[model samples]
Target: MSPAPPTPAYRRLSVEERRAQLLDAALSLFAHRAPEEVSLDDVAEAAGVSRPLVYRYFPGGKQQLYEAALRSAAEELRHCFDEPHEGPLLPRLARALDRYLAFVDGHGAGFTALLRGGSVAETSRTTAIVDGVRRAAAEHILSHLRATDPGPRLRMTVRMWITAVEAASLIWLDEGKQPPAGELRDWLVEQFTAVMGVTAARDEQTAALVRRVLASEDG
Candidate 1:
């Protein structure tokens, strides 16, 4: 008879690695289920660890784990809009939107819980995390637009578009992710152009941006 395969070596995880593993597991659970519906045991099972192990890493229990998971998820959400400064602005924006929406698709329930509010796990910290994503995304987009010194109108326009994107994402999830992601991304890019066009009439900064963006696309 063939000899049994040798047992794999038992490797222990480092402190930071273990913690990250737990956070990743917690986020995975939170992705499809509301935080309130997830427990430490759920996280432990997902991570292939014990409940006490989870508690050891997050002594504050479920709330602590939930907060930590949100922080992790926040980082990912913020990075979704981090597009390189190259080529046409609309194409860049489209690529950014694609990432953002993919994240929303993957973290459906968690995204809803974070934005819809009123979750048992909801706290000031969680709200701040969400707000931080918004601010970071706005900054990244403004950077892409070369609006380092954005006027109030331009800033408001960008922020409003951000809000609209969030609302649309929520609605998209509620509608069972219909209309396809690519179509949604294109619609959002078009919306951005339209809003920028309207804002250009009153904001010289925005007008210059419209011209520059259009010229680049045309080129």
Candidate 2:
């Protein structure tokens, strides 16, 4: 064998790149462990950097890093419901749920840490971040329903479904993700349809939506 090849020199990352690397490491740690349990040292080690280096990028320390990580996760969760308008509404919703559930599954304990709301790392800003995700998801669903300016009943129905999705997601995690994800997705779609049908009985807007959905399905 030839003599050991020359090792490449370490390349320096730009400020943004280095910050992103730190954030990714922090997020990964936060993904499996509660933010309160994770430390700045852990993030530094995970990123293969020194603790001082981590502080250099995040002067506010672990709280700052945790907030940043929460923001990143929140952005991803918000995008999960941003499905295209081309498909049947249920199918679109199913696809969005697939993405959302996948995030929940991947994040595992992190999902609980973010949503459970009693962690030491929890802050008003972080709470707002989580709320923003819920609002964004509701908006996406409303848009998919073609309800640009939904009335109180329609809006409440859509928001209720969103809350149910969150509750079901938490329950799924507690149940160790039993019944499989596809089954969960289908069940959620069914639940949405059922809830909308019940609401339609008393709400004209929901009734019109049900008729449109039925026509689409019949077609």
Candidate 3:
């Protein structure tokens, strides 16, 4: 009998490695096209594998592939939230927020895909992911505040401040990413520090007025 041809290097990769390779290719396609529009053949071609091989990994088909991509994105986000932040709370908060923004900028398509995938049915899970990140940031802020300014209302105030930051970040990203990344980073720190009683509120009010004027001109 004739000797069988050796398997390709990619095919020789471990199951986990192969799955990750397929997902990376699938994610790139999803970025360019919506999940529903991506075909198995397209993914196979992108991954340099056969249609049957793609099917073998994704037995249930395109939906399974999509879920895998979405899950990967979500897990990455969750892991980011679990990172440790050292130093004063406000600085830590700023760093965390910056990291989150950077993630969104780099992975906007992944974020969009996970959000539109329709698999994340639990509102609490979404809130947990969102609020969990903010809470970690807020904790650092609150810790820094308590080190100097002891108060009864600081907790509530810090929570509100974190909520504002989370909302502002989403708005900033959604509305054309204005103010540039550096400016936005400064603004986040200024806003958080002001809330913690380190900086004056006048600056924040002034910034708000500027935003309003610019928004009016755009409209």
Candidate 4:
């Protein structure tokens, strides 16, 4: 018979660590549920802490906590398009889309509420946070296109693609994440490629970008 093993000592979390832990717990709940559907008790249970402790950290109660979680999700979505300038544009975009789609899959419930709107928790502040993420994501994608001064047509095309990706992601979540994430990501990349091809026909700047992207891939 084996001897009983010692139970690990439980160390107290510092304020920052405790706050981060609570936020993580809240995010996980929010990931699968609407903000109105989640209670502070749920967050406390998820974090393995007491309910009053959750209130202690978030004095303004559930509203404050929901806003904090919203900001965190927004920040993550904003960075989803960030990729190293090390490869061909198409491949790099595919990698970014993989990260983006993974976030969508993990945060399906919260994402649907965020983008689809009409939630009780939706406020101007939350709306601004979501809009900021969209702008930041567009900026990141534009950077990869090497477009420092993209013309109107090129800019509009990129923005349209961002909107399309967001809409497609919402539909994917609605359909129970069908067709596989990889398939969705590859299809998005192809859509971007095709759109760029069409845009290049009428826009010199986009045409130059297409040429540069193709040249990099051939290298």
TM-score of each: 0.93, 0.93, 0.60, 0.92
Best by TM-score: 1
User: Considering summed lDDT, which 10 consecutive residues are worst modelled in model 4?
Assistant: 3-12
Which candidate's lDDT is highest?
1
Error of 3 at 31 (Å): 2.7
User: In model 3, where do residues sit more than 4 Å from their true spots?
Assistant: 1-11, 116-176, 189-219
lDDT of 4 at 212: 93
What are the per-residue Cα lDDT tens digits for candidate 3 across 14-113?
8998999898888888765657678999999998888999899999888778767656665655454443534434444456667777766666555554
Candidate 3 lDDT score at position 69 = 68
How far residue 20's Cα lies from its native spot in candidate 4, in Å, is 1.0
TM-score between candidate 4 and the true structure? 0.92
> Compared with the true structure, what per-residue lDDT tens digits does model 2 show for residues 95-116?
9999999999988888888998
Q: What TM-score does model 3 achieve against the real structure?
A: 0.60
**Window of ten residues with lowest summed lDDT in model 1:** 3-12
- Backbone clashes for every candidate come to 0, 0, 1, 0
| Candidates arranged by TM-score, highest first | 1, 2, 4, 3
Alpha-carbon local distance difference test for all models: 0.90, 0.87, 0.63, 0.88
**lDDT tens per residue, model 4, 142-209:** 88887998788998999999999999999999898988999999999899989999999999999999
lDDT of 1 by residue, 1-219 (tens): 997764321248898989999998888888789999999999888888878988999999999889889999999987887788998889999988999999999989888988999998888888998999999988988898888799999999999999999999999999999889999999999999999999999989999999999999997
User: Against the true structure, what is every candidate's RMSD?
Assistant: 2.4, 2.4, 9.4, 2.9
